[model samples]
Target chain A: MSHMFRLLETGFNPAVFNMGLDEALLRSVAQGESHPTLRFYGWKPPAVSIGYFQGLHEEIDTDACAAQGVDIVRRITGGGAVFHHYEVTYSIVVPLAHPLARENILDSYRLFLGGIIKGLATLGIPSEFSPINDISTGGKKISGNAQTRKLGCILQHGTILLDVEVDQMFSLLKVPLEKARGKLIADIKSRVTSVKHCLPSAGSEPFESLFSTTVGALEKGFAKSLDLDLQRSEPTLKELEIAAELAAGKFASAAWTALR
Target chain B: MKLELIGKPEGCKLLRLTIEIDATAGLSAMALIQSISIRGDFFAIPEEEFDALERALAGVALGKLGLEFSKLARERGLQCAGISGEGLDEIVHRHLATLNERN
Candidate 1:
């Protein structure tokens, strides 16, 4: 049986607005006003998103982030800090009782990430869904994901790395120990891989085309692998209004970002 | 006493705990937890339930922190990933034992 899904390609948005829109879509799907959704988006001005349970000051160098014109926000989902740049971010919202849902966290990730794995394959990159919220190619991580279940729906969001700038990432994020920063940076460089690095002709292709190219590949990958009838759509006016409020009121608020 | 401890159980992510201990009968008395903030890259579904777990840990004796935390987490049915009650129990108890050695 083919499931119906709303596909929204909301190109670029501020960090708070991006997070708010994801939550807003989750709420709408849970309330039965909209279909389960698969949305692809990008962050404007770049950004750093920390996990819900993480301490803001512990993970981020706010002064550096602001100085570099990067936005910062706390995700409702729990995971490590993520530098949102040179990546194609995707969010999938599905009801708890949906066929794709799993009771076990690891099993849920295995099932939900099948599309990503298949999508990577479509791009000529064979990837596996690494346990505990990651997608890996070979042994290096290519993507990181975070998920939260609320209001009878599961909202899983993640980033697919198109390119990586490990040094810039380290500059924006604080290490566990200042002295170990060099070692940590070296370790991340070895352990992380990206689409541009993996794809044969990706380097020659214009950087601007990577986003659309990857998004298109992923859209087809999800539809074929997940057995979905996806209809192109826009964010409903109600969703946009609610997202704007959430952006200003929750995601952008200091109390919420510094919640831990 | 303000105590900060870091633990990383075999199968869980790094857990950083900033705890305030209130000793009821002076330094030698039973140490009770004034408050605890659990921070890490762990996943707990319906995060509010996890927040409630933080609140529910109040006044729990330092010795029983693990038991109480495990019990409350199980009761709340917070689906967790990268962290576990047993892992937390082992981490807290092990850290305390290390603290005892310092004195």
Candidate 2:
């Protein structure tokens, strides 16, 4: 029998609430308050999320972010900083004891990310899971994921680019060398691609249509790949309350964001 | 002397090591590890464990840093991608050898 998974389609939210919901879902699943969950979400006002151990000042351009009205939040998982815009973000929370969970980190990533690869395949974008948590197509990274195991559950989240704005991303992120900024942006543009770019069939479609189509394909992809019997649902009141509290107290706080 | 070494091992993230080594005694010794920062686009689960792993390597001899790092990772059951203790050790040793040649 396939494992039953709760599916959440949280369209778009501010950065803090989005992160807060992921954390809350992680806790809820850890405590057996809910079953395993797979959520698809987007960022509103866009955001820059740095890894758990990253030095905020080292990775982000604070003044640029503030001027552009981009929110910055620290993630509980470890990876490079991400500019979360023009993307489809997904988070999965599964108990460690679940059959889907693997004790080995790489093994877990391979298994979980298979769903993503399958999803992309459905979109006609043939991608592969690169070791350690990246999904790539045509030798360019299409998705990057981060995972964390805590409170007896595994929480993994990542983004699939729908469209990329290199200049805006570089504006919010620090360049290792000021002189190399242009080269860096050019390099990233070459390496990073979006679903829209990959799918010639979706030519001239509105962004919203393309976004929904991608999300739909990913949903079916996860269902088929993971053998997940997904049931559509909304966040429970308890989860919303917890998420609200976490958003206000943790994710949105300067102390937490600057904790590097 | 302080040695700042960086290595981007194949299939691993970049590992940067800043070590204080003592060579006044005629042989290089690990004086102290000022800091060890791993960067790049890699993932390590239970992210906080990286700090513990770094702390565990603080005072080991230069010759044994790699082995020590590998052993500590095993003991802690660390899960890392795009970086390995053995790979990092190779980088550190390579950098140290270069420094020794110059001296």
**Candidate of highest TM-score:** 1
Q: List the residue pairs that clash in candidate 2.
A: B12-B82, B12-B83, B13-B82
Where is model 1 more than 4 Å wrong at Cα? A177-186, B24-30
In candidate 1, the residue pairs with backbone N, CA or C atoms under 3 Å apart (3 or more residues apart, or in different chains) clash, namely none
Reference-based TM-score of each model: 0.94, 0.88
Clash count of each predicted structure:
0, 3
Per-residue alpha-carbon lDDT of candidate 1 for residues A1-260, written as tens digits (9 for 90 to 100): 89999999999899999999999999999999999999999989899999999999988999999999999999999989999999999999999998987877788788778888888899999999888899999888998999999999999999999998899999998766422342345565677889999997898777569999999889988898889899999999999999999999999999999998
Question: Among these predicted structures, which one has the highest lDDT?
Answer: 1
The superposed Cα distance between candidate 2 and the true structure at residue A152, in angstroms, equals 1.7
**CAPRI quality level assigned to candidate 2 from its DockQ score:** acceptable
**B1-103 in candidate 1: lDDT tens per residue?**
8777776776677777888889656432258888999998899987999999999999888777777877888899988887776777676677667667887
